[model samples]
Target: MSEPVKVAGLTVRPGEKARSVLTIPNFWADGQSLEIPFMVLHGKKLGKTLYVQVAQHGSEIMGLDALRRLINELDPGKMSGTLIYCLPNPLAFREKSRATMFDPKPGGMNRIWPGDPEGSLTERMAHKIWTELVSHADEVVDLHTASRYCPVWVFYEADGVSEKAPSETARRSEEMARLFGAPVLYVETEAYGGRRTLRASCVDNGVPAIVPELGGHAHFDEEAVNIAYRGVKNIMKDLGIINGDAELPKRQVKLKWRADPKVYVSHCDKGGVFIPTVSLGDTVKEGDEVGFIYSPRSFETLEKVKSPQTGYVFTIRENPVVHPGERLVSVPEIIEWLEN
Candidate 1:
């Protein structure tokens, strides 16, 4: 058996059943108290290490539910490998908010990649997580969902296109997504500017990682929960962590990629109440009216939202209220057969 890996000051021995919580000091309201909570599950058999983390952006709760169910169903005595469950920043989660204390003022934890141990609270937490949890794992799955006001479909972010070893990371992400059994996987090629982002950092260090969107935030949907739950189990099965057949749906959904940048941003022309006529997964063509914005009190149509390209809708705002320059929808310009 291979030797165990150490993360965040914790030593995880291979083929040993163990669970422990790693604390990050003063991550909450200033330097008042510690806030981050991580649960490490080391199975009794040696296998690949996988890090399953949730609530990095605060509002994504589907991952939490999935992780809860996973822990309940997983039996360490009948398993192999190590699974690390990390709550990188629990303050935002406790407050039921997206982004952390330093968000907007500085930025969200998800955007603060690699991190600085001597930086702000969020940065320190990020640095610890990277050194301890993320850097050690053979594969990483970061769970997320849309913000409180938006509902999005399941997708994966594999920003491996810009890298020199594109296919290497892309293939690993595709395999992980397939193991998770998600219906769709979206590849994001654009850079969002933070070097500390989990996905970016993983790729930078040659660790295959993908961030799966688990639907919406705050409230839980039974179907979405089931999808995420089974998906994690399937991933475990694929990793040889468990030795049993995973009951996956027969009609598995194939992955589709979005190739155009213009399809991802739809701005509100006039500030008012915005009503979406199309839902996530809907398809539209150029010049098609997607939605409209109007006065909430008067119900008068002030502006209309139209598709600028032929594509599939991936994300939409559920909240009717809108402001000028806000993103109302995100559609992906579909690319076929890239995976095959």
Candidate 2:
């Protein structure tokens, strides 16, 4: 039998299910408290513990629905390992804002990892989550959402300075991402800045992690929810936490990262109503006109937005109106195609 796991003042034994909330002290202006809710499922047999969290950014709520469905579907008594589903940032989630609105410097929750107990409000909450939950997990899945036009994909951390030789944790994270069954896999090869992110921090601590960016936000996207559900189940199966094989894509593309100036993202040169000529998942070569910015008043093309490199169009702005220097599209560099 699997041993008992304790977190957030709750102890879950083998073949059991439990839920609890971790209170964040000194969280509100009126001296009220905030709580981070989490669910635990401990299996009957011993296996790797997988920690999955959603809604780090409040508006990104699609993953939460997906997680709810997953929790309902999973049978803890028939499983071999444990699963932790957590909602980490209550302040942002409650306000439906990306950051804690009241904090003086509420950088998005994703930016800070292994946080400081005596730091800002957001940091204090993050610190509690890191120490009490994530630090105990063998693997992690950090769920996020992108624009409505963005396709579902997985991101694994890589060494930007030395892309060829990645750390063992990063390599394991890549394997998990592959089993996640996302159509696109993004390898974030950054040596710095990303270290503070949840997945990167897990990798730095020798715990494999992957961030699955689901499609759309703020609403119930059935397609995105299905994708998230399947991906999590696939990971569990691959990890021997559950029975069955992972249903993955026959072929998936891996994108190489560019940190210097964010070559993946193409910006608008002139402010206007931007219209995209290419849709998400479209392949385009460098210098190809992917979109055009037009002035509604003058009825003239202000500028033609082109692809920065030859790759897949992963993210396109859904909002037509845009200003100069705003991101119009993100086409990551396709490094290779993996056959599954």
TM-score of 2: 0.92
Q: Over the stretch 154-187, how does candidate 2's per-residue lDDT look in tens digits? A: 8887754333334777778889889888888888
Which residue segments of model 1 deviate by more than 4 Å? 1-17, 24-35, 103-106, 148-160, 164-166, 193-195, 245-263, 294-303, 323-325, 337-340
True-structure lDDT of candidate 1: 0.70
Clashes of each: 5, 0
Query: In candidate 1, what are the lDDT values of residues 8-89, reduced to their tens digit?
Result: 6666666444455557656556676564667666776777778888888777777778789888777765678878888777
Worst 10 residues of 2 by lDDT: 158-167
Q: Highest TM-score: which candidate?
A: 2
- Regions of model 2 farther than 4 Å from truth: 102-106, 160-166, 192-194, 260-262
Deviation from truth (RMSD, Å), model 1: 3.7
Best by lDDT: 2
The local lDDT score (0 to 100) that residue 254 gets in candidate 2 is: 92
